[model samples]
Target chain A: MAKILASSKDAMAHVKSGMTLMVGGFGVCGLPENLVHALAETNVKDITLISNNGSVDNWGNGKLIANKQIVKLFASYIGENSELAEQFISGQIDVELVPQGTLAERIRAGGAGIPAFFTPTGFGTKVAEGKEARNINGKDCILEEALLADVSFVKAHKADKLGNLVFNKTAQNFNPLMATAGKITIVEVEEIVENGELDPDEIHLPSIYVNYIVKGEQYDRRIEKRTYSSATS
Target chain B: MTGVSKKERIAQRLAKELQDGYYVNLGIGIPTLVANYIPDGMDIVLQSENGLLGIGPYPLEKDMDPDLINAGKETISTLPGSVFFNSAESFAMIRGGHVDASFLGAMEVSENGDIANYMIPGKMVKGMGGAMDLVAGSENVIVAMMHTSRDGKSKVLKECSLPLTGLKCVKKIVSDMGVMEVTPNGLVLLETAEGFTIDDVVNATEAKITVSENCLVGTY
Candidate 1:
C-alpha cells in the first residue's frame, strides 16, 4: 500500500536538487498543484523537467521555471509560458521539443522497461536529426530513447487507500504514464476513499506504481483558453 | 462569401473536403475554423491530440469545464458519443492510421509536399506539438493558409526555407487565392477563389503550377 501523506511538504521532502522529474498535465489540467507549489517553495535548483507543456506564466510548472529551479525542460509545446520562452531565448534554460505523440510514447516506454523504440513520426525532419535512422518495412523510421525520471508528480480525482487512482475527463493526459516512469511516484488527489470503495475495474492506475499519496488542498484548474459560444454568453 | 476574410475562405474551402463518417484532426489557428463550417447533417468526429475524440462546439459559459479542452487548450464540449483517453492512447489512434484526415495550418509548403511550420530558427521556436505525427500517420493531409506572407512573398515555394515538419506529406493546399493539389508532377490548380483571377493566383504563387482544364471559380 502507498503511504498517505498529510501535506505536499512531506511528499516533496524526497526530491533533491538536480533531479530528473516528470510532471503530469496538459497545461494546468491534471497537474499536481499542491506538489508543484511545494516544489516552488524549495531551494532545489538545476532540475530537469519532462511535461507536455509549460503551464502558464504564473502557475503550474511555470512557477518552477520562474523560480529558476529548472535547468532543462522536455516538452511538446512552449507557447503558453512566457517565462520559459524568455529563459530559453537568453540561454538560461535548455529545451528539447519532442512531438506530443512521441513524448507520450517515450514516457510509456520508460515505464514498460523498454530502452528505446523506432518511430516514423519525426523521420525526415529536424527531430530526426542526429538520430539513427533506418528503413523498416519500406517506412523511414528514427530511433527515440525512453525517458525516465527520478520522481514523478501526478494528480488524480480520487484515490483509494491502496493507491488505485481515478482521473477526471480529459485531465488524464499524462498522469497514468508518468506514474510508472518515475522511481518514486508521488500522487496528489482531491479525495481519498477507503481501500475497497473504488471499483477495481474503474481504477485508472494500479497501486503498484504509486509510492506516496498527498491529499490536495486546492485545485485552481485554471483554463488556459476560455472559449465559449456567444449564444451562451 | 463577399464579407469573408481570406482565413475564413480558406477554412470554408477545406470544410467541403470532409465526407460523412470522417474522423478529422484540426490544427490550431485557421484549421480550427473548419469546424464552424462543417456541413450540417454530416457525421464527422473531431479528434484533439490532448486526448479527446468527437469534440463538439465551444461550451456554454455555465457549462464550462476546465478539465475538458481541445488540443489548442480552449474550453470545449464533447458530443454525445465523445470518449476520453490518455495521451498515449490518443497518439496511438493517430499514429496507427485510424484517423481519416488531418487539416493543418502551414508557414510554408514546398511544391513537392514538404512542410515547414514548426520553427523560425532564432525568431520563433514554438514546438512541433503533434503535427509531425498527424502528417506522418493520417490517411490524408491538407494545408490551410494564406497565399503570401505578410510581406507579399509567396509561401507556396519550390523549396521550404524554414525547417521542415514533415517531408513529402501534404496532399493538398487551400489558400486565400485558390485550391491546389500537390502531385508528383508538382502543384495543380484546381480552383480559384472568388474575386481572384487565374492570373492573380499564378502571379502570387512562386511554385510552378499547372492549371487544370476543369478549374472552376470557387463560390466561397
Candidate 2:
C-alpha cells in the first residue's frame, strides 16, 4: 500500500550505475516517459538495458541511450535508432540482439523460476551458435537461458493503490513480462484508482510483482513514425 | 519499363496466397505491402508481433492515432474486433502454432528453402524481429523478395552464403520475376512474371530450378 512513490525523482533514486534494467515498450508504446527522464537527470551510467528495441531516437528509452547511461543493450531490433546503430558499429556499447519471441520467453521463464527452456526458434541459425541444441520432436531446438533484471521500468494505463495494473491496447507488449522478471519493479501509470476499484479480470499485472508506482506527468505519447494517406474520416 | 514495380509485383503475388481466415504475420518491407493488395471480402486476420491482431488498413491523415502503430513502427488502424495483448501472449500464439501463415522478406533463399534474412556480417542490419519465431511456429512460411540484388546477383541460390533465419522453412517464394515452390528436388517454377520466361528464370537463378508443366504467368 505504501508502494506509491512521491514522484519520479524519488523513484529514480533507487537506481545505481552498472545495474541491469528492463525497460518495457514496443517502439514508443507503453513507455514510462517521466520515469525514464528522471533517470536521465541522474548520473547513473554503465547500465545494461533489456527491452524490445528500446525506442526511436528522441523518446522512450532512447533518451537513456542518448544520455549515455547504457553500456550494453539486449533487444530484438535497433533499426530505428541511428545513434544506437552507430554506437553498436563503433563498439561504444555492447549489444545482444535476441529474436523477439525468444527475448519474451526468456524474461517470462525468469519470472516463472525456470532456468532454461528449449525453443526451436533459432535452430540452424546464427542464434544457435555456441548454444546447446537437442532434437525435440524431430526438430532441432536450442537452449535459451532465462533473463532477469535488477530493476524494471514499465508503463500502464491504470493501476490501483495496491498496484494491480491495466495496460492500454498494444502498448502492453513487454510491460507485464518485464514487471515479473525484475527484482525491483517501478511502474508509471496514467491513472491510479483504489485497490478494489479495478476489476479482477482487467488487471494485466498483479501487485506482488510491483515494488513502487508513480503517476506519470506530462505524457507526450510521441509517435515513433508518422505517415499520411489521402483517405479521410 | 515494367507493368508494376518489382516490389509491387512481388507483393501482388504474395497477396494471392492468403487463404480466407488465415492468421497471418507479415514482416517489414514487401511483406508489409501485401496488406494493400488483400483480396476484397477476404477475412484475413493480420497479426503484428508487437501485440495486435485483426490489424486493419493504414489510417487516413485524419484518423491517424499516435498510439496505434504496427511492429514496423508505422502508423496503422485496427480493424473492428481487433484485440491487443502483450508480446508474451502474441508470441505464445505464434510459438504455439496458432498462426496459419507468415510472409517474410529475405535476402537470400536456398534451393532447400532455407532463408537468410536477418544479418549481413560487417553491415549493421537491424536485428531479427519475429522472423525466427514465425518460421518455427507458422504452418506455412512464404518469402517475398527480389529475384536479384541491385548488383544482379541472384538471390535464389543453391545455398545461402549469409546467416540462416530458418533451416528449410520457406515453402514458397514470390519474387519480382517468378513464383517458385520449394520442393525436395529443388525450386519448382510455378509462375513466371510477365515478359519473363522459364529460360529467363533458369538463366537468372543460381539455384537449379525445375519448370512445372503447368506453370502459369504471374498475375501482376
Candidate 3:
C-alpha cells in the first residue's frame, strides 16, 4: 500500500542533497509544480537532475537551476532554458545532452531491469563518441546504459487511494517510467478518489511503483508557448 | 505563390511529397508550416515526439489545453484518431521505423546526404532533441532549408562544416532555390523553384549538381 501524504513539503522529507533525482515532465506541460516549489524551498543541493527538457527560467526544474541546487543535468533539450545554458557554458553545471528517444528508452530500460541496450539512434554523431560501438546486422549500433535515480517526482491528473494513477492527455510523457525507476517515487496528483472508484484496466501506473501520494494544492499549468490558429479567430 | 516567402514555398513543396495515409514527423521551424499545406483528402498523421500522434492544427485560444502540446511546446489539437502514450512508447514508434517520412530543418546538408543542424560548435549548442533518432529511423529523410546563409554562403555543401545530426541519412532536400536528390554519385537537381533557373541553383550551391534532363519548374 502506498502512503497518502497531505502536503508537498512533507513529500520532500525523503529527498536529500547530492542525490540523483528524476523529475517527470516534457518542458512545463506535465511538471509537478507544488512538489518542485517545495523542493526549491529546502536547502538540499548538489542534485543531479534528469528530465526530457529543461523548462524555462522560472518554471519546472529551472527553478532548481535558478537556485543553484542542481550541479549536473541530463536532458535531451536545453534550448528553452537560457539559465541552464549559461550555467552549462560557464562551467557552473555539468550537462550531458542525450537524444530524446535514447533518453526515454534509457529510463524505461532502468525501470524494466534491463542493464543496457544497443541503439542506432546516435550511431556516427557526437552522441556516439567514446562509446562501445558494434556493427549489428550491417548497421552501426551503440550501447547505452540504463539510468536509475535516488528519488522521482511525478505529476498525474488523478490517483486512487491505492496509488493507481491516470494521466491527462499528453501529460503522461515520462511520469510512468520515472515512477518505476526511482528508489522512492513521490507522485502529486490533482485529485484523489476512493480506491475502488478507478477501473483496474484504466490505471496507467500500478500501486506497486508508487511509494507516496500527495495531493497537489495548486497547479499553475503554465503554457510554455501559447500558439493559436489565426484562421479560427 | 507570387507573394509567398521562401520558407512557405519550401513547406508547400514538401507538402506535395507527403503520400496519403502516411505517418509523418515534422521538425520545428519551416517544417511545422508543412502541416497547413497538407493536401486535402490525404489521411496523413503527424507524430510529435512529446507523445502525441495524429496532431491536428494549432488550437483556437479558447480550446487550448496547456497539457496538450506539440514537441515544439506549442498548444495544439488532436485529430479524431489521435492517441497518446508515454515518452518511451512514443519514441518506440520513431526508433522502430514506423514513421514513414520525416521533414526537418537543417543548417547544412552535404552532397553525400549528411545533415548538420543541431549545433554550431561554440556559437550555438542547442542539443539534438529527437533529430538523430528521426533521421536514423524514418524511412525517408528530407531536409528543408534555405539555399544560402544570411551572409551569402551556400548551405548545400560538398561536406558539412558543422557537427552532424546523422550521416548519409538524408534522402532529399527541398530548398528555397530548388529540389535535389542525394544519390551515390552526388546531388541531382530534380526541379527548380519558380523564378529560379539551373544557373541560379548552381551558383547558390557549394557542391556541383548534375541537372536531370527531366527537371522542370516547380508549380509553387
Regions of candidate 3 where Cα sits further than 4 Å from its true position: A230-233
Query: What are the candidates' individual DockQ scores?
Result: 0.84, 0.75, 0.82
For candidate 1, the lDDT comes to: 0.93
What TM-score results for chain B when candidate 2 is compared with the true chain B? 0.95
Which of the predicted structures, 1 or 2, would earn the higher TM-score when compared with the native?
1
The digit string of per-residue lDDT tens for model 1 on B1-220 reads: 5677888888889999999999999999999999999999999999999889999899888889989999988999998999989999999999999999999999999999999889999989889999999998876999998899999999999999999999999999999999999999999999999988888998999998999899887556
Give the whole-model CA lDDT for all candidates, comma-separated.
Answer: 0.93, 0.88, 0.92
RMSD of each: 1.1, 1.6, 1.2
lDDT of 1 by residue, A1-233 (tens): 69999899988788999999999999888888899999999998999999999889978999999999999999998987888999999999999999999999999999999999999998988899899999999989999999999999999999999899999998999999999999999999999999899988899899999999989988786888899887734
**Model 3: per-residue Cα lDDT over A1-233, one tens digit each:** 78999899999999999999999998898998888889999999999999888788967798999999999999988887889889988999998989999999999999999989999988888899999999999888999999999999999999998899999999999999999999999999999999999999999999999999999988887998999887645
DockQ of 1: 0.84
Kindly indicate the candidate among 1 and 2 with the higher lDDT.
1
lDDT (Cα, 0-100) at A177 in candidate 2 = 96
User: Which of the two candidates, 2 or 3, achieves a greater lDDT against the reference?
Assistant: 3
Please give the distance, in angstroms, between residue B216's alpha carbon in candidate 2 and its true position after superposition: 1.7
Prediction-by-prediction clash tally: 0, 0, 0
